[model samples]
Target: MSWEQIIFYLFAALAVIFAFLTVTRRNAVHAALCLIFCFFFIAGTFVVLNAELLAAVQVLVYAGGVVGLMLYVIMLVRGEDASQVKQALGQKIIAAFISVLLVIQIGSIVYLSFAGKATGRLAQEMARYGNTESIGTLLYTKYIFPFEVASVLLLAAMVGAIVLAKNKLER
Candidate 1:
């Protein structure tokens, strides 16, 4: 196999391992750090795919910005609030069912998208202006609204975290 394929497989495996650690860790800070590494692996995949802009954004936005925000929120959480909350058996069963459904849904969607894809204009565009420039143009023009909305949503989450921290402190 090629070196690129080997690197891709390595990155994918590390990403999954990090993601599992992120979700399963008891400490919020540790989990957040694991998640940051997971994001780094995803960024590495973007680089392997020749989408340099996406890789940079993955590092900057997800690894740097979002993870920084998560660390800040985790720091704000009080010790008592950090205690593990035990889930009931029913809740665990429901969560497992939902997860299975989500996996099935995502698998079908991916299969359908691959099976139905016909056009290949993307290669032509990439040949002309390159991936980064094309992404920047499209993101600025067509996806501007969603970009703004995402920023607003993040702002709301930050505010909510602060509010929760404040409430915990007041009690």
Candidate 2:
């Protein structure tokens, strides 16, 4: 196999393993760390797919900013004991079933979408304009309003989080 294929497989394996750990880990801090690794591996996959802008943004925005914020929150909310939390058998079974179904649905959709013609078209488009410049131009020109809206949403979320974390009673 080619180096690209090998790298892709490696990143995909790491991403899947870390994502599973993120969901299943008992400790909240450990889960957050696992999620960071998952994000890193996903960034690697984006790099392998020649999406340098996306890879950089993934690492900067998700791995660095978001994870740092999450770690800070986790530290602030540290509990004396986390092991005492218990999950019911029925809840576990239901969660597992939902996870399995969601995975199967996603796999089916991906498989069907990229089975033949769609893959060729995607490749063609990527080859034509899969660079930072094209993405920036599109974002600023065509999708400017949506981009601004997303920034507003993020700002609102941050404000809400800070409000929720404050100890003072609101009058």
Index of the highest-lDDT prediction? 2
True-vs-predicted CA distance for residue 11, candidate 2, Å: 0.5
- Estimated TM-score for each candidate: 0.70, 0.83
lDDT (10s digit) by residue, model 2, range 57-168:
9999999999888888778778314657677889889989998999999999988887754212345567776678789999999999999999999999999988987899
C-alpha lDDT score of every prediction, in listed order: 0.83, 0.86
Error of 2 at 156 (Å): 2.3
- How many collisions between residues are there in candidate 1? 0
Best prediction by TM-score: 2
Instruction: Go through the candidates in order and give the clash count of each.
Output: 0, 0
Please estimate how well model 1 matches the true structure, expressed as its whole-model Cα lDDT. 0.83
Per residue, candidate 1 scores C-alpha lDDT tens digits across 98-151 of 999999999999898788664334566588798888888888999999999999
Please give the lDDT score for candidate 2. 0.86
